[model samples]
Target chain A: MPHDHHDHPHALLPPEPALRVKALETILCDKGLIDPAALEEIIDTYQNKIGPQNGARVVAKAWMDPDFKRALLQDATEVVRDLGYYGRQGEHMVVVENTAEQHNMVVCTLCSCYPWPLLGIPPGWYKSDAYRARAVREPRKVLAEFGVTLPPDTSVRVWDSTAEVRYLVLPMRPEGTEGWTEDQLVALVSRDSMIGTGLALAAASVIEGVEASNQSVEGTAE
Target chain B: MSRVHDMGGRFGDGAVLPEPQDGPVFATEWHARALAVTLACGSLGQWNIDTSRHARERLSPKDYSRFSYYEKWISALADLLVETGVLTLEDLEQAAERAKDQAGGSEEIQKSHPLSSRRLLPEQVAAVLAKGGPADRQEGPVARFQPGQKVRTRRLSDSALVNGGHTRLPNYAAGAVGHIERYHGNHVLPDSAAHGLGEAPEPLYAVRFAASELWAHPEHPGDQVVLDLWQSYLLPEEVA
Candidate 1:
């Protein structure tokens, strides 16, 4: 939405803050108070630079090993503990299993609180006010806007989180992977699958190229 | 013109930012870009006022404009915290210190893991997972009014400073009264910012206003603007 440049009562400031901040930042830069390189290194090592794809590798490993799947479903945090997928906003995680009876969706009515470790930073639309105000009022309509359709009777429960228990949706495994390997199954679990938006990676017979990134923080397994 | 605090003018102005993605690299990080516009505005000394409390809250017009709804809420909060005495300029400075320290040694800071950390425990996780997670905490109605109750929408400003010589919250429904047709459950306290308090997740009510009361056209005159406003925003009206 275009910001109204019109007069707002609170826009009043002492005028000195603007100049003060610039001079302070300049001095900090000159004195090396903040390291530009260090910030880059930190982001590369922790931020959106690494995610879902690494989790995809873990998911692939699990499909090849039943012991791992059991471990994944039971205690996902421990299961993927070694990968170090959890980050600033996603230190704590919850895996929601999608079954025949129910479906799950997530929202942070307060802000776009996402599980960035598994899923990358949320899309811009997720953070928009239209979604926040409308999602609660009419979720089905909102989902449709995202190009997803659900049965008329399917109840969509939108979870509005508050800096706690970030969520990831675990879709039910798809069919036709009878003799698939771990890597093959991992290839099937798309990012959308984890968001509970799309189904678990569809069968290879109809599978398309891996166009989008599917790196989940928790290491999703088909 | 709308009041400085009203947000009605926030409809499709084509100012929304693009999706967050790790591409050829925009400015080093996604958040930096996501908040770049707003942060720049904040640097410009542009800001708004707390309509609920009439406090001076500084926010950039760009951030104020481009921010998603919840981002606005959070921004408004940070603004109010600075304006009111709840959080001082130094408090945020200290909070940043705390955040930095917490970032380095978070293991000691968190007292108990939120429920998600212990999902292996079937019973507790079952409650959240089965119910699709916790319900939003809210406050219930104060009963100062009831359904079929006549009430007036209050006039409020959208910001502390005027940008275009216009306000965000117009007097469209100023002094215009309507009936409390529907009652949604109580919600989080709206006065948290004004009072310089943290949210307690209380209850509030949703009051409905006839469409005619807020706008010019009349589909049903009954078609209304349903507001999940805090009780503090409403006052008891006498029966006519």
Candidate 2:
């Protein structure tokens, strides 16, 4: 049997893992196996370029344009690529649409395989053991934890992404956003909404969220 | 082999925590470096993404659960570096010693180590990222089952688990009956791909299993779980 490292005294310490990573990176760099600058470039791409905002933009555009939505639903890979959010885990894309009678959720039961190009890095909880196990078994309970309460009559569909093909849930467009521009609609879209764990925030709720965040930032600044 | 990493339906871990409204891409610098090293080394073409994932999954269950997400990445990175002959164990040990020495003193270690056999040019990174790894093979055997066909996942024996070969089929879905939602076209099978057993491209499908059918007592009768399953993992329901 393999030794259990979890029993180590420092396993719970956050700095220890970081230190180990630094040590390995230093060694890899010293051995010329990895380029630190290239690593930074990759990080920048994921952090700045590839993210939920891109997916939000896609969702917002889909909401405004019926043709794009149809194209996205028919062939997401081509549509997403045309929009420049095509790479890595997003080579093969499938957009599941949420309707009045059905809702969709995504989970990678085996590992944390996600559409990185669309939603950026998955949130920490998405990779948790509990979510991976429960999302497929008890999706409604999982969605409830995310504060996404659906009507009892609506059926929930859980997508377990077990292959190279990735999925992005096209959440239903919220009400009271008539004639909204794509840019304005982007504010209502959140990363969780795209993952199907939560629904798109209402137009007014989005404003309230922004104001709340701004107030918190000001409080921190003060 | 069945492992904790293959987490589907088994429970008792803990509650899922909510994510921060707006979290940074990476919480710490090391996390970013870990991602970079994984991607940089991955660009070397030594091993594919599926193989890298198997390396991480092959970690002992205790370590798998204990390590932070990035920690798992670094561990797998080190393993792959040695496995691919990009770096020797001695080279890694020497690097570790150098890191330790730098930590304790002002001694400057020479940054003159020989480069790996393969290196991706900075200019190639964007194109490579944009192109991505499309698993679909141009030519392969015809798909065995079509959409709307009823099928059952093949059951694995205990010996199969003991042998410890990597497989894309999750254990929980094994032997369960589901309807073929759609044929996803020919794609490289990860079970064989992870072990250097050739691409072994085969037909894949979106198999839709009702939540009630998958679990003994499902939370909701209306719930459904769709898994992208490889053809090799399934058989005709009548034959199963």
Candidate 2 local lDDT, B120-195, one digit each (tens): 5566677777778899997778999978899998886122322576777887788889999988899987777788
| Predicted model with the maximum TM-score | 2
Q: Give Cα distance to truth, residue B82, candidate 2, Å.
A: 1.4
Worst window of 10 by summed lDDT in candidate 1 chain A? A6-15
**Superposition error at A116 for model 2 (Å):** 1.0
* Cα-lDDT of candidate 1: 0.45
lDDT for each candidate structure: 0.45, 0.81
Q: Tens digits of per-residue lDDT for model 1 on B33-111?
A: 2232222222222232113223222345455546444344434534543443333454344334433343433223222
Query: Could you report the Cα RMSD, in angstroms, for every candidate shown?
Result: 13.5, 3.8
Give a tens-digit lDDT track for model 1, residues A1-222: 333222321222112333222222222223232233333343343344545565565556655677876777666665655666654446445555555655555655434567666665466665666654444334455556555676644555444443234666666667777787767777777665565545565675324443222433234643
CAPRI-style docking class of model 2 based on DockQ: medium
